[model samples]
Target: MNKKKYQIFISSTYKDLITARNKAMETILGLYQFPIGMEMFSADDSEQWEVIKQTINLSDYYIILIGHRYGSLTQEGISYTEKEYDYAKECKIPILTFIQDRNVPTTTDEREQDPSMSIKLNNFIDKVSATKMCDFWKKPEELPGKIAIALVKAFTANPQIGWTRVKGEKLQAVSSELAETISENRKLREKIEELEKLLVTQKPVLSVSLNSNDPIELTVPTLPSPSKYPQLLRRDHIPAHLTPYITDYDITSYNNSLPSKEEFEEYNKNTRYYHLKKASIDFDISIKNDGKLKAKDIFVTIELPDFVEVQDKFDSYKNVLPKNPIPKSLLEKAKEKYIKDNNIKPKTSFGVTGGLVALGSIIKPYSLEFSSTYDDIIPHLTKSQSINSWSSVKDKTITINVKNLIHTRQKTFDDFVLLPLKAGSGFINISIICEEYDEAENYTFPINVSK
Candidate 1:
């Protein structure tokens, strides 16, 4: 068995991130691969660059770990680390970049001492971030896990031509076998030619019959009642008021003629109603295969147009009376008497004030009942959460398969509530993308919308 190992070049600022570089080397070694770094070269060494280029050329992958320092620069003023990265990129080596997390606080000693060096390091970091997909790590311990994932993904996506060794005896045997197979194949071809000359062949006449189905007429139906068919309330047809009920007091003030506790409980239960109109779109798709051979992986893509906008529902008030009614006559008279007497600003007498207080006490219970009803309606109103299920998606794409060459499929995407944006003669442009057919299958049709 021949085992292949990938040589990965690890380039980064050396001194400041010795710990991170060591961790990376450990990760590559643990994966049973080679890790090349700048450990052998001294600071500001220009002679070793040729050797570094040779190493990068031989490497299968390149990984760089960036830190605060830009490292020693060459005569050209470009850092040696950046020069190595440029060479690796020029050689088309697969590069994985790991950057130090900016959020992580670093000690002053750990960063570049020179301000210019710090600027160069930042510029280098920016270049790497923009050009390649990078990962940020705060600690050296995080390097192993992240590096492992990135290396695995890179190797899987673009596998390198790694070294492999074979036994001399096996190679000789394969060569001998290949020669014998070639000679045998040549003789077999000659025999096949002789046999073909001796055989007689004839072509058969093929007959074809044509049958057609009657034209299909698709009619758009009017919108149906929402109460009758709630499932049809999908898309634009879905009422904005999804809540089943809203109390009458919520819609209006109940200061004067407050209903009795029983009457308030029943009559103010739900006042909101949602009306629905028929939202139906019908269209036909025809598939024709002119070729004699059958096609596989046959598919059709249907792009539905922006049919309608979600609109408010038509509503009407329905009087829902409570079973046990509280006669309004007594409450009405009390309220009327209070209003009449309050017209005159009387003197501040305890007896007169107490009399007025008594009148309020009479109407206070009904007021409490009305307030209680408001509290009770809160839970029910909260439960009436609105969901616009159909409005979320702009269009639908369907892929289908038909058994025969000539086929017509009648497709109806019904129960989808459509609130036509415009009234009368609206065009729905359907885009059809067929995998098998070469010609364009797209078409446009008109729809009439009424509220």
Candidate 2:
């Protein structure tokens, strides 16, 4: 069987996963996605899903990053991840998944969230890894190394470029030794190219010619999730010996690892549109003159496309499908049932709504709503003050990710005064209530917390 060249289609929420997504894509495109901020890109680059779809369609591999809210649907009760995954499944693209930790919920009194590391991460392991699907890194610092590994695996499993067999690429042939030899990032590409060139020079026959008689398969088989995995995705054959390793299993702060797939379903009435609690993203905003506001732990918003209509059920083509921007979501439960019981694709269709919605943290790399420096500095704030909350779904946007949750009892803070959230196109009003009238009428001072 002659394998087709693989182009990875990165599916993720913009605000959350942008940095990581771009970082992953960097191995191939090299800053190609620089301007495509936290939301959907315009006609210039990723204007349509066509580019993503076409890449996945023509290629043999796929990468799905699982952030929090993996299975969230729009008002129409559709999950965007499900839609994209559905398409990937249709194309039979070989998928490798990376999942990150959702916020491990904590109570008000605690300084730390008890570091619920493995339990939260378990959802990821259950849904994503197998012989076919594998993990990306778990920590932010680890993403690049993990992505590099994924790219190597990708280049190996389907070693062909344009028409030639790209040498040094074979599944399972990429040992840690070869990975170690990759050495520094500066020389990485050059070294690989040199190695490939040398191999071609030494063994002229190392390269093979493509033929028309090759059997074109959709996706190669993926390794199955562990039996004890939280959510059992499509169960494929995994070696029995591998089972021993899967038990008690082992999750420590090890090397880089991606989380597993996550999901949600419907218990609502109409099923067309489901109601949701707004995600309140709590963040601390320290304002100074625009040189660089050290907004610690700033969060990104992952809103449904405004154009996406929330209905009781999935929208049929005519009633739902948009000519361009397909931004609709579908109920994962319904799709899973359809696949299990009826074997069909989602009937609902939508175009991407407003700007771009993002998930995953700065680790995934998307729009920079705050200073990129904030990303590198967040871990040092041991005070554990900033927070994010998800409120009700409003106008396609999950309003008030409320990234900063710190309250100040002091009337006068340092130059780092938190200002009123600016009113803009997205807001109804910016309510700045001065709790007590100042004798000097000083607007610069921090007002008392409004009752």
Candidate 3:
């Protein structure tokens, strides 16, 4: 690695601190560092201030020496030394301050003759002392030693990227590499401009819409009663030959009664509701890509109000209920024959062979009993493939990833089911985001739910 030499800027009033400034410059040079000062330009000239700022910009560190005189003022009514210090601070250069000790006696020529200038000098000294930790110097000779110590500490604490001399061969190689890099950068910038123009003209246009824009009406259906089905009581008593015919209704009804508490608990892990009704509404949302380019990595998010709910799958009461292999008509006919044969009285309790218990008045046959061999009393809603494969439901929000949608193609998400928990009116918000679009496309549709 090449050793680096830092450039240090020395800022001070010329007449009062000329000797001190010289000592600072010598100290920096002795340390093998470059020194920049206002020696070349007249401090009072406006044009020289620009040159001073430029030098300060190139410097890694700033050293300011304050004495009895504030020095000559610029057009801005501030001393050139103070102006330079401000510019250094603006550039965020590391600064070292040396203030003259007030106790040290100074000759008439070395001190400020004007009262106004003396006040400004004292204020300037106070400003520097308040802002930075400053060293006190009694004489010009004290600056060299103090400056050397300060510079060493600064170098160790805050190292700077400074000047280094490279070999001739290495310099030529670096020059060639830099030239190639600049040329490549220019070509890349041109390509980027061309791409941006093409993007503006051939942008993908995406439109999202629902199958129906009319406000969705929500309705809640009564929960199916398990007591209506008598076959549930004979789940274990059903013949082995009828096991395949056992519908989800038989299982659900048996589970609801929970005849064996332990077995039912193990079989059903979800919460069970005997009376609470569940309501769900299904809808379709479609997205059409009309632009020339394909819309890649598309995500659609639908957010409903708190009263509405989105579920991955809605539980249906079908083969899940109690099942009995015997038909209800046969059971009724057998009961009438048994009554006529035994001459049983009304409101009599009797146990049938298949764990069938006749309760309440016999005058009223089980009012809700119905018999069907078909398993699909309640049809299953067809699930959308895209939703089943790449969708998630959380509370009232449903997020679906439709992957890449090709140009001039439309995709319909038909699996979304909205369950309303209560009656409410709100807008269903839909947001679509894709790689081809600069921003998300938002849409809304009204929904009114009634009990």
Candidate 4:
């Protein structure tokens, strides 16, 4: 196992069932014999929404502690549970939901009085479930072992998943604010009760010097560390697995350089990085409100005329969209550009292109659901790999299998392919993921089939 550990954020509507949720978390930690990386909120601490996001950002896995009435309304608007899940999705963090057997909210004739709340509640539950996350829906006694197994599987897949989920304040900002506010209210009462006592210590929580809860500040001026502060933060401490494929990287310069949260969020142009000479490129397609944060089903594609070739300039295709959803003419232009630019194109085949057919089916009911996923490498016909699932990844090596794949209705996470490179492959090709294909008994690449 790699010496590096995982940080996971245990997120839920913590107010409603803190005891059961904390016990489940404790059981999970105890089962693992208490690794140094794992952390969870106490009953007194769960009400703070900002703290939850910070925990989520610090963690690799957003362990949603799902029970009845997941602690949203009590905290006020901006459910941290949803925020963490959405942000984690935005950040590409894996989610593992642990559902307790409390009856999930459903509508009945008597309950129809507040059908709106019921509808909202069910929608929230559905959104959380839609991620197709690994779940633990068992009795309290059965939860410990199940949680342990899931963590082990997820950790064996990637220690970073656990490590990054619970690291910083940015993860907890929105979620913990409500909790912190509640904490202050309780503190104010305590302070009133003990007004006669001589105060001995400086209060860090009430100090106005620091910014809001998000620990990962884009502002350099605010990131000053105390003398005893750990100078370097490992992936476990960085909150949320920002880069899912790679094992470790440095953020000192980015921390020192960026101006604010918005600036440091993501770069506009495509950026490239190398892990021991294996090439990886990264570019963010802005998140949409249509409940998708993945690479597939993105509306726009920009091609630098020189960088991309085939039919025509990508700019020309913009006018054709969203009405004529599949731009076959544009793809034809792109194919021409690919052939012209690469020069070593495949010989003319009798069959039509799969890319065209794939795009054409987007509007056919479920056809467009998870199309156009991201891939690190340009997909080729000869060979490919599908990631049904992955177990803890250590030092850049992820144990991947083809059987763990689950259908996701969203475009996020399904965009990248999981390639299990062999030992001695030199560097890990940690690329953008894509979930583009259906499960098949046998699949041959360049899948050009003709009638």
C-alpha lDDT score of every prediction, in listed order: 0.57, 0.37, 0.72, 0.40
Q: Could you give candidate 2's per-residue lDDT for residues 1-451 as a string of tens digits?
A: 2243345567665555666777766754532211112135432343455665665566545667665544334334334554566677787666667766545442343112334533433543564555465664555456667766666666676553433344464633656557766666648788899987775444211111111213211111222222222223221322332333332222221111323333112212112221110111122222111111112222222233222222211111112111111112222222243344543333333322122122111132222333455555455433322333333334433222233323221111111111121121221111111112122111221111110
Candidate number of the best TM-score: 3
**lDDT top scorer:** 3
C-alpha root-mean-square deviation, each candidate: 23.5, 44.4, 14.0, 37.8
Residue-by-residue lDDT tens digits, candidate 1, 332-388: 344345546556333343335423333443433422433445445444421111231
Q: What would you estimate as the lDDT of candidate 1?
A: 0.57
Model 2 error, position 256 (Å): 99
What TM-score goes with each of the models?
0.37, 0.27, 0.44, 0.30
Residue 172 lDDT, candidate 4, scale 0-100: 78
Give candidate 1 regions above 4 Å deviation: 168-451
lDDT of 4 by residue, 1-451 (tens): 4344565556666545556566666855664433211224433345654665555566666566665553334344545466566777887777777665535453342122455665665777777766665564644566666767777777677556233234467767856987899999999989876763422221111111011212211111121122121233344543232233223333443234334433322221111111111211111111122222222321222121111112111111111112212113322344455445555334254334533222333335432322343231234312223343222323423222333222222212222212112112121122122233222112111111111
